[model samples]
Target chain A: MSDQPTGVPREEYRPSPSDIAPKLADLQVGRTVVTASIPLSRADLVRYAGASGDYNHIHWNERFAREVGLENVITHGMLTMGSVISRIAEWAVDPGAIVDYRTRFTSPVVVPDAESGAPDTPTTSLEMTASVGAVDTEAGIARLDVEVTSGGTKVLGRTQVKVRLS
Target chain B: MAVNTELQGSSYPLAQPFEVTREAIAQFARATGANSRSHFDPESAAQFGYSDVVAPPTFAVIPAQRTEALYITRPDAGIDFARVVHGSEQFTYTRPIVAGDVLAATCHVDGIREAGGHAMITTRTELTTADGDEPVATVVSTIVVRGEDA
Candidate 1:
């Protein structure tokens, strides 16, 4: 399916580190380095629940989630946080290069049931974009300011990741 | 029910050791869509200086959250699972968690306060190697408990 839920080009979905690393060496602050779209479904969340051992009802049980005031089954904040970091890790070409990562959950990404048609599709995707926020050449550390949006709403705030790249 | 503010500064001791297995790392990688070979192939992981398949960066949350629930689930803690919303998460890793390593986590309630008629609780989980007490990673998580009106 098209990744233009937000009108972004498909080429913007997977960014390679080599595409921006050269500029990073020159301390290119405020440069947009990477963009990726993470598609999620109820089955995906169920798999994440098994992998992460987070049996939170809001993440899977639709009835329970609504009972607690949530519109429907919602994705686990950690799962979203975890899944998005894969792009950063891929950019590093080495998963071990990421030394620090943090994020504040600003809003919920409601996962509609497949039965909920049209405007409220069940298969939603998160759009992640990362920019070069800071670079310390001496420490070989680069700080990235990441933005995560789902359904045109920013779901994470102050999302950042620090990488140690030699 | 409103969360009890008195639980601030409470620290929960380490529980049983958590073993990191290649299977678990691979499962997490697949679930999170992390396509890096280091998370699944032992040979590729060794090429990256890891002895075995390295876990995805956020995999630490699995064990850390399991430990944090020790206190959050206590009846007297006044934490209502139904009303809680994850607010934030941060992680600092000393090294990549590779397969075959066993870790133990200690959970500390770093901060608890009220804001906008809601309760916010911050927890820090320190992970260390089970064999030598060598530090592995530190995970900090903040959760908000919404009041009835919210």
Candidate 2:
């Protein structure tokens, strides 16, 4: 369960909002290729389970999680969906411009093991691509087509967000 | 799936209030891969112009779930919980909810219909200040109960 997978490194994040161009300046419209990853741990699963009241044993209890055919403790699909929201907020040219977002849970994130805060397992690598789904400068609004994945698995629920930007 | 058209637009009240605490916010931050200092530390939150550790925008679901019970468990509404697969989740925030804001979420069955071989029910939950005077955000979530096939 603690095996490290071959792909990306631990806890990698990129492209803070300050790094992006004026999203609506010239209004570049097309697909965006982005990749990021986050470390998974028991602390996260428990916290989310409590906050969201999911209480699904597969998300926490290690033994129970294994019995259910999971590689390790499974992260709540909602939690992963929530993490996607952060990437959106971070990617937007205006950090606070996110007005709405919606999506379904198509995959479950496996909880990774760690040793005293040292990563003991492989992190969930997210390779996502976004495209201009819509643009309305007058409304300061834009929508993006999104697809997320963990490892080679495509996380279901193609996500989209409506945002207000500069 | 059979039809339940009358259930459309039926509104329900929440039995409990969502208590916002600094610990709750921190817990949510850890799980969501949010490395933002403001969500985990009160001092940082205050520096960000918040009263205390502010929860991630998606953290609203914890409190929102407290109200979802009304719609999901309505016996007369003819919903079979075992067949429900979360169809969608969406959120809109008016502002960041600090640790002190006591939230109350009320669920309204905005609409219901039989579609794509499933019963799709739309639920709109309003997370508001306890007195219901100020609005925080509205979570519009929909679920589809599969018709024997799903």
First chain TM-score in every candidate?
Answer: 0.82, 0.69
- List, residue by residue over A48-90, the lDDT tens digit for candidate 1: 8999999988998989998998889999998899878987887
Candidate 1, residues B73-131: lDDT per residue as tens digits? 98989988888899999999999899999998889999999989899999999999996
Q: TM-score for model 2? A: 0.75
Native-referenced Cα lDDT, model 2:
0.68
**In order, what DockQ does each candidate have?**
0.46, 0.37
Query: Estimated TM-score per prediction?
Result: 0.90, 0.75
**Per-candidate RMSD vs. true structure?**
4.1, 5.2
Q: By summed lDDT, which 10 consecutive residues of candidate 2 chain A come out lowest?
A: A1-10
Stretches off by above 4 angstroms in model 1 are A1-27, A116-122
Tens-digit lDDT track of model 2 for A53-150: 78867777778666545567777777777767666655662323566777776766666666444443444555565666778888878887778777
Q: Runs in model 2 with CA error above 4 Å? A: A1-27, A31-34, A38-47, A57-75, A92-96, A106-125, A131-136, A151-153, B1-6, B46-49, B115-117
CAPRI-style class, candidate 1 = acceptable
Q: lDDT for every model? A: 0.84, 0.68
Query: Candidate 2: which pairs clash?
Result: none
